[model samples]
Target chain A: MNLRRLIVIGIPFTWLLLFFLVPFAIVIKISLSDPAIAIPPYSPTLELSGGWAGLKAFFSQLDFENFTFLTLDPLYYTAYLSSLKIATISTLLTLGVAFPMAYGMARAPEEWRATLMMLVILPFWTSFLIRVYSWMGILGKEGFLNMILLWLGIIDEPLTILNTNTAVYIGIVYTYLPFMILPIYSTLEKLDLSLIEAAEDLGCTRTSAFWLVTVPLSVPGVVAGCFLVFIPALGEFVIPSLLGGSDTLMIGKVLWEEFFSNRDWPVASAVAVILLAILIIPIILFQRNQQKQLEGDQ
Target chain B: MKKLSWFNLTTLTLGFAFLYIPMIVLIVYSFNGGRLVTVWAGFSTKWYGTLFHNEAFLDAAWVTIRVAVATATLATILGTLAGYVLVRGGRFWGRTLFSGMAYAPLVMPDVILGLSLLLLFKVMFGSMGMTTIILAHTTFAMCYVSVVVSSRLLSFDKSLEEAASDLGATPFDTFMSVTLPIIFPAVLSGWLLAFTLSLDDLVIASFVTGPGATTLPIKIYSAVRLGVSPEINALSTIMIGIVTVGVLTASLINKRKVVQRLKDEKTAN
Candidate 1:
């Protein structure tokens, strides 16, 4: 039995190690190599003397250069901060919209619950890229929104809604809203109604009972939803790239440019390492909280 | 009961409208005759005709289908295995590591994941192309599939497998005959999820795909960068139509099962 268990576990472990872990290790190693101008830095064969010198140079070069450049450089820091700000704002907005929707689903008639849940997830099946692009048609200068507004005499001029920060926020929130809703809905679905009934029987108003009982009970789902939104939003590339204007510089776009346009692999890796570090704490907390919830249920 | 208060009804109607209006507009405008994406110049199927003839778009679509299918299959297999182990196997050396590896891709930012994969390809494989895109997508796609499959595994009955094993069948035979059938639905769902993710992926594909290996999303992105046109709208309309049909079908099937299970419970009681 033990050997069977080991074999079962070992297959996935070996697969992940070979494909996932080793690849990441190679990335870190390549980041430490010198960028060759005439040839690609990643040569199939390592030049013996050049490799030793490159290793030494890599170690010596690993100072505050990349970090300082990322921080002190106005463009870099601005992009990093703006990306965080957008992601944070979008996450909060999604939570605001999704909370009420989830609560409504939870409280709705049992017959309607599944249909409502389907409504919430229906948008998710569509291509994410297509959904993001659809926003352009709705928010562009001559797009549907503007046309409708003009017909209604709401505004004389078309709104400059496309390719802006607002557009980026809208795109991010729209894409991630389902992620926020499902977890919260699952938690709310499993919530014991008797607890609420008890609170009410004790003379707690619906509002007070919701705050004092339901809200506290759904903390795990809230955390899961937030982490789900925040982590991916932080590194979101597609929305910001397609909808965001020049002003909407994000870390993901920066990393893309560094690797593809600038051919700066080392700096991109450094940036990635930093992003990974930023994500570690929240991910660990979210996972721990989720595990505890699972154990509690079990 | 408030008996459907006006405010609640209004919110529900408006929320659905907000979700559906943009999609409707995209669908309607796909038939627009003019090049202008916004203005509906008397309905025509020219854009659909145009879409058919656009070899570039067709090629990208083909590439996307290939990638999605391959990633879905590979991720589903690996994920089913990982899910089985995580839910049913005993804790041992490297179990934690395996779990971490499986879950790590979920939390990692797409940018970081894409960049890391790009660097890996450059260092080890010396090329950025379709294979890299497939590898990067499968990395996270497998994680998602594993999570979904594992949740299903958790609720599964262990005794059925034991019963089968005791009935003079080998473990493999028992798994094939008993376990596989029970988990097949979960595996199918996992595959669908993986397929959608692989198809929707843009950031990772952008970082990994070479010049000739652009996918549909990449093509649409580049076209949008130049300018939005009815052609893109036409493409989106078709894609959204397919997705909507798929989602509605799945939900209908799920609802039927739920109702059947409820009836069974009530009958037992």
Candidate 2:
């Protein structure tokens, strides 16, 4: 029985150790190496020499230069700061839009909740790139939104909504709305309505009761929703590249350019390592919240 | 359910409009007789024909479908094992690390994940290809699959397995007959989720793809970056149609199952 259990657990544990954990270790190792002009773009970690000399050469090659370079460069600093700014703003915007929709869905007739939930997730089921691509048609100079505004004489000229920070905000909020809504909706769905009703019966106005009762109860959902949106949006590459202007300097875009455009693999690795370090706190908090929720349920 | 208020109605209408108007516009213009995606010069389906005739696009689509299927299958098996361990392993050594790995990828930034995997592949294999892309996709997709399956396992009844073991069934036999059947639906849904995620991925695939291994999203992303056109719109419309049908069908089946369960309980009572 003991052997059987060991085998059952060993397979997945080993797979994750190799594929998941080892790859991350490689990223850290590569981040410590020097950038090179050759194929693979970073100085080789292993020397071709056999035995102790090769081991010595590998250890000698690793350094802190890439990380030091990132610290000295204003562009990298700006990218990191701007990414946090964009992610924070976008997370708030998504919450603002999603909270009402989720509240409505939770408060809807019980028979209709499933269909409503499905509708919220329906957009998510389609191709993410396609959904973002569709926005180009709607937000461009000659796009649908501009054309409608022009036809109505609302503006003398088309708004340059595409390829701008505004566009990035719109894209992030749109792509991540479901993430924000689903969590909040799950919490709201399980609320005992009588608590709100009881508050109202005690002469608390509906609005105040909502603020005092419902909002406090739903804090966990709000936090989870924000983390879900903020974490991914912080490193979002496709949306900013497709919709953002030249001025948009998100760290994800900067990392992509470093790796692909500039061929600076070492620098990209350093950027990734730094980004992951920044996120570790939120990641730990998110995990703790999940563990707490699981224990609460059990 | 509370009575629907004006606030609820307005929120629903406006929120859904914000969510869907762009796709609606894109689908409408896919049939535009004009070259511009936004301009309607009466309706035409020439772009659909053009999309079908594009050899590169077709090749990418084929590669994407194959990768998605492979990813879904492998991720399902690995993730099911991980999920089982998470809920049932009962204080095994290194269990915290196991659970953390299973859940971390759920929120880990895609760029970091992609870059880390790319570095790993370069060191190990010296090149990127479809195999590398499959490996990356399965790594993350399995995380999602694990979440789905583990949640289902959390609510699973332990007594059923105990009963089977009491009746002289071996552990494996009890799992095969009792636990597997009960969790099969969650596993199936996990496969579907993994498949869709694999199909939808672009950033990771771009980071890891080699020559001739371009996936559909990579192709569409590059094309859209340069400029927008109706052929891409037509392709998007077709994909949207397929996804819509798939989601609606799945939900309908799920609804029917729920209804059947309710009826069964009523009859038993």
Candidate 3:
């Protein structure tokens, strides 16, 4: 029994320790270390052969220079702020688009609900890169939207939608819509239909009952869905990089450019540390919400 | 029978249409004869032919499949074990930390994960390549698999395992026979999810991949960054087709299994 227990728990536990947990520790250590011009990029590799003085030297050498650099750079600050704003707005947009559809799916005849759920999940199974890439053709100046508008005689010239923040918003909402919809749909599906009837029977109109009951009950789903969308979208690199223009400022892109474009490992690690710090609250809330949902499921 | 009010119908239609139209447009334009991507031209299968002949794209795709397969297998094993431990291993040391590590990667942004892994690999392995990419993919993908499998195990009928235990089967034997069969479907779904994630990864792969080890998504990303091309459209169309078929087939099999189980329960009762 002990042997079985060890193998079952120890294998995965060790793997996570080595890979997931250890990597973040390395990131933190590297973030404190200084950038180097040598191979492997970061410097002051701690040497134990020289004993206590070497350790002291290493500790003294470790500095927050990279983190201070981050504070000094307006670019990083702006990118962080913009990423938050973009994530917020896109999450709200996803909620608006997904809630009604989730409602529709939940209210549909029972037989159709399964199929509708599959429809939402289908895109999730497909390559996310391809889904995001699909919008390029449609949102381009001479793309389908413009072509249709011109054919309808709405305008003589095509509007420039690609290479803009607006395009990022569209891509985010489109991509993350499923995440928002599924949770809301699950909550709505479990909703007691008799509650609505009871509300209507007790001098409430359909609209009033919906507003008071359906919307309020779905709040848990909404909150869960928002965190689901907001967390990833805040740190999004692909959508903003592909769709947004030069003016677009997102911390994920900044971190990518810092590491790859500028080859500054320490700085990139510092940026990542900060990003993770900001994400901690939302992540904790999300964890709590999911736990609550799981307990409710039980 | 209650019919959907027009509001629900309109919203559902519009919602699905919004979700689907972009891909449909890409599929339609993949056959365009002209060099331009957006404009309509004479339909042609030439681009698809061109895609088949592209050696670079083909090599990247092969690499992607190999990485995906390896990542999926490793992730499924580890994830299933993690799920089992979480659901049935009883309280153990560091359970909270273990569960946190297991679930954190699901929401972790790819860039930070990619960056952190790159930093670690540079320190430990010194050279990032296919091996490192697989390791990185498995690290995160296993988290997703654990979530799926553990959720299934959460709802599992535990009395079956207890029955096996009471019948004088060892705990290990009971787990292997009684528990494994019941959780097989969730385990399979987790494997599929991990496989798809590895296949679709670009960001993490980009961070860990060395020269000559580029995956398909990275190749496609660079190509797309160069601007939209008909060849890419053709590639995407094929990818979309594969995913559609895979998902539909999986769902159908699942549906059949559910029906069969229901029938079996009726007979047993």
Candidate 4:
């Protein structure tokens, strides 16, 4: 490459290497080191004696004790499995709500589509903490939902919703709805309506045409949306901590408590590393899908 | 008339209601005279008034603004360069890896990203505060900015730059005079995105922040955990109002540009 090209690529490459890639390596290193009562709460891997020999000693001291401890602790296993289950359920719930809205927006009059799109994304622009926080008033015992239900005579007593898995579901689905909607809407908006029309003109009904033509074409968008929601939801700390009951044992919260409350940095690092390893599968899949889409466009 | 079908209308209405009602209640109750967020005795702006005087809230807000501005500007610059390079620098070494790094943070869990970055900072810098927070925010925010700018870059017209170069302008000159101006709007949007993200961040900020570097989100989180307060509702309402105005203005500007372009095409035709 020429000088200009070299400068252009080198900045981001080096920045990401130092900030993103190196940090992940540090996480793995910290995961292997034993927890200490030191300020950082982890044993120093590199006791800088001199140069190369110091590095060799540091490498030699690394152990898999944290990883083994994670397996030995039943709480870790429960947290991981519960997080996975909650993430999966929330992803499905988000998709269910987002799909119809996206479809409606995609099928709206051309003149209104831009405004509709803006409206969908407008909520996302606000503080996510605030958005989740708002649910407190709406889902609490004396909150609006219960008040409305009581007034409507739907229930005799206010059903407890806050600090429950249901609340977490509501929060997750509510917060992530836009992530699901935007991608699917973009794909659906670009869809060849003529294909659906052609199917309709044949013996197929409109619903069948939708299922056969639109659904199949929107799979990439659906996949992208699911991954977007699932990956973050898997390690979500805010929603579950804020909205979930004590029984909602998510790995993200567990990891946070392990580090901050228990002062177990190695265990936290191990949890994060394991989480990253699990998420890598979906990340790679999403990247490959995006690459395919890009090639298709080209 | 191309109107929504009943099913479509129901879907839109319910979905929108679901999205907005909680926010609307929060906003509405922020003005409640009563202390309770749920019970509205009458309209009052007490919470908003109190928010202005709260020293902790004010300090966090100031810190947040500083971090947001710093992160937004730096991220936009770095992200623009990265995006331009990704699009224009053809088949360079480690290009694929660079692209992956740029996009990976989008889906990487905040917990993992925050933990890893915190570990890096503790080992390298040995202290955490405003600088570490800015670095962490910029790291993630730049990825978002790059995504925004690169999408714009994908549709960029290379002919304009080529024509500028053909007229004796250098590559840098062509970029500055021709390419940058054309893509300035995208860069601006990217900056706004980065700023908003920096403002919205809590988990990552919590991990990296030191004693005096608490942000608005972190403060709000701690306060909310104590229990829902009308002050938080008022604060949230103010934030929501600011964001709404910002988004609407941006959308209006973009819409006007689209209309102007369409009118130009019509007149030309």
Candidate 5:
């Protein structure tokens, strides 16, 4: 490549390498090292000045202690499993809500589709923290939901929804709803109406036609949407912290508490490393779906 | 066109309501005269005034804006360049790794990104605060910007750029005079997205920020952690209003541009 090309590509490449990629190396290194009370918060710093001897010493000191510790602690394992469960259930709920809406948008009159799409995208322009925080008012013990329910005589007392798993589910579904809708809408919009017509002509009922043709075809969008929601919901910090009770055991919350409350940087790093390792399968699958879509478009 | 089905209509209405009700409540209650969040009193703008007078909130707001603007501009530049290189540059060494890096941050969790970036910053600069926050935001925000810009580029009319260069303009001249203008909307949206991402960030900012460099989200987080406050509701209302206005105006501009393009195409034909 020419000088200009080199400079253009080199800048982002170098930046990502420095800021995005290399950081994981540090985390992995820190996770294996012992925690310290000193500056930088971890021990056995690689002494590059002593070159080969320093490298040897650092390598020799590195152990699987942190990873092992993670296994021994039931809290860590429970947090991991709980995060996955929450993410999975929330993804399904988002899909249930979003699919119909997306279908509606896809089937809307041509002029109205843009407006509907804009409405969905508008909430995202606002702060995510604000949106999640907004629910606190409605779900609180003395909040609007309870007041309305009590006034209607639906319940004698308020239902405890805030600071619970249900609240986390609501936050996840609400915040990530757009991610689910947009992808599904795009795929459904491009669906060939003729296929449904053909199916009907071949003796399939309307609902059956939708099931066999429309639903089957929209699977790609559904998968994409699910992964989009599931991946972030798995690692979600703000939602669980704000909405979940103290007993809720999300890995993100656990990691945060480990680093901040306990000041155990190494253990936190190990949690993060393991989290990323688990995410690899889903990430790779998402990447493949995207690649296939691109190729199919071409 | 097929008529809308009742089932579809019902869902669309319910879905939008679910999406909007919490925010509408939040905005409406921001004007509540009472200090208690759930209590409805006479409508008042007192909370907005209170938000303005709060020195800590104002300081954090200013810091947040500075971080956002810088992050947006830097992210746009880097992201635009990266998108251009990826789409047009083509077939470079380690292209797979480059593409993987570009996309990975999008799916990566905020906590991990924040933690790892913090560790990196400590080892490199041993520094924290405004610069660290900006760098951290830019790193992730640029990845998002790249996705937006690259998607725009993917379906771009490359022949226009090719035509400009074919007329003997230099590549840089062709890009500046032709490609940039054509993709300006995408670039603008990318900047806006980056700006908002930085403004909205709480997890990453908390991780990388050091003493005396609290951003608005971090400030809001700390406040809300105590309990919902009227001042925060007023602040959120302002943010929602700004975002709503910005998004509506952008959509209007985009729609108008599309109309004008179609009109021009008709006349040319």
Candidate 6:
């Protein structure tokens, strides 16, 4: 029985290790190698005939240039900072919009809860790319919003809303709002009503009771939702590329250009490594929070 | 008691409006008779007819369906295995590492993941195509399926399996007959989730797809770059309709099952 269990689990474990883990290792390895035309570029070979130099040539090529370029270059820092700023703002906006919606859903009568939740998730059925494209029609200069605004006499000219930071922000929040709401809803559903009642009985106002009892307990969900939105937003390529104009320089766009346009695999891999490093802190914190929750339950 | 504030109602209305207005516009514009996508030229089904005749759209749809079905099936199988391990396996060597590796794809940026996979294929396999795209989709889709299945597995009872084993059934037979049936609902849900995600993917598909392997999302993306058209809206509406029907049907069936189970439980009691 134990052996059978081991075999069942071992299949997936081995599969992931070979494909997922090894591919990443290969990326890191190639990132450390020299950019050359060889079969496996920068791999040191003893034979000097095949443009292969000794180990010294390989080690010497692996210098601080990649790391230095990421820091000293103005473009990289700008992209990194802008990506962080956009992600943070969008995450906050999504929270603001989602919290009340989720709260309303949670407090809604049981019969209505599922229907409301379905409404929230229905948009997600469409392709994410198409949904992003739909925003283009709505936000374009000659599109629906401008047409409606002009008819209503709200504005004389179309607004330049399609290709701007504002547009990217809208796109991110729209795409990720369901992610924020679902986690928050799940957490809120399990919250103990007695705690809020206790606060009310102790002479606390409704707002104060919420601030003291409700919000604190739902921190795990809030953190998880924020991580979900923030992390993806940081690496968002499609939304920013389609909605953002020249002004919005995100890391994902830069990475894409580096790999596809420049064919700079080493530099691109270096950028990926740096991006992975940036993500590690939040990933660790989120994992720790999950572990703590599990252990607390135990 | 404080009166219900107008502020809550106004915000709620605005929120729902923000979510629905774009979709509503898309649906309305799809039926517009005008050559221009934005202008109202009265209602017609011309765009929907145009969509039917567009061979490229049809071909891309076929490719997407093929990829989604293949990815969903393979990912669900692998994910169920992984979920079973996480719930039933021992704390053996590299267990934490395995679990983390399985999940890493979910949080990793699509651009990074796609680029890395592309680079790996170039270095080792010497090509970028459907096979690579399927593999990449499976990596992340399996993670979602595993998470779903494992959550269900956590609440599963083990004594049934133990009893089957003690009653002279082989371990494989016990799992196939007893354990599989119990967790079949979760596995089915996982498959549906994978199918939806695979259909919805664009970023990874763009990076890894080759000359002839373009998916529907990729086709829409490239077309949108030129400009929006009524045909695109028609396609979007069709996709939305299909998915809506599927989700509603699934929920209805689940509700029926729940009612039936309740009745059975009452009768047993």
Candidates' TM-scores?
Answer: 0.93, 0.98, 0.98, 0.98, 0.98, 0.93
**Top candidate by lDDT:** 5
Models sorted by lDDT, best on top: 5, 3, 2, 4, 6, 1
User: Each candidate: RMSD to true structure?
Assistant: 2.7, 1.3, 1.2, 1.3, 1.1, 2.9
- Candidate 4, residues A97-196, lDDT tens digits: the string is 9999999999999888888888889999989999999998888998899999999999999999999999999999999999999999989999988899
Q: For each candidate, what is the lDDT? A: 0.82, 0.92, 0.92, 0.92, 0.93, 0.83
Per-prediction DockQ comes to: 0.60, 0.82, 0.84, 0.85, 0.86, 0.57
The residue pairs that clash in candidate 6, if any, are none
What candidate 5 gets wrong by more than 4 Å, as runs, is: none
Best by DockQ: 5
Residue pairs that clash (backbone atoms under 3 angstroms), model 3: none
Residue lDDT tens for model 6, B51-152: 899999999999999999999999999998888777766678888898787777778899888877776676657777788888878888998898888878
Q: Model 6 over residues A57-170: C-alpha lDDT tens digits?
A: 655656556667778889988998899999999999999998887776677667877777888888776678878888999988998889989999999989999889999999
Model 5, position A297, has a per-residue lDDT of 81
lDDT of 6: 0.83
lDDT (0-100) at residue B39 of candidate 6? 80
**Model 3 chain B poorest 10 in a row by lDDT:** B34-43
What local lDDT does model 2 show for residue B110? 86
Question: How would you class the docking of model 2?
Answer: high
* Model 4 lDDT per residue over B32-116, tens place: 9999777778989988999999999999999999999999999999999988877877887787889999999999999998999
lDDT of 3: 0.92
Q: Give the TM-score of candidate 6 (chain A).
A: 0.90
**Residue A85's lDDT in candidate 4:** 97
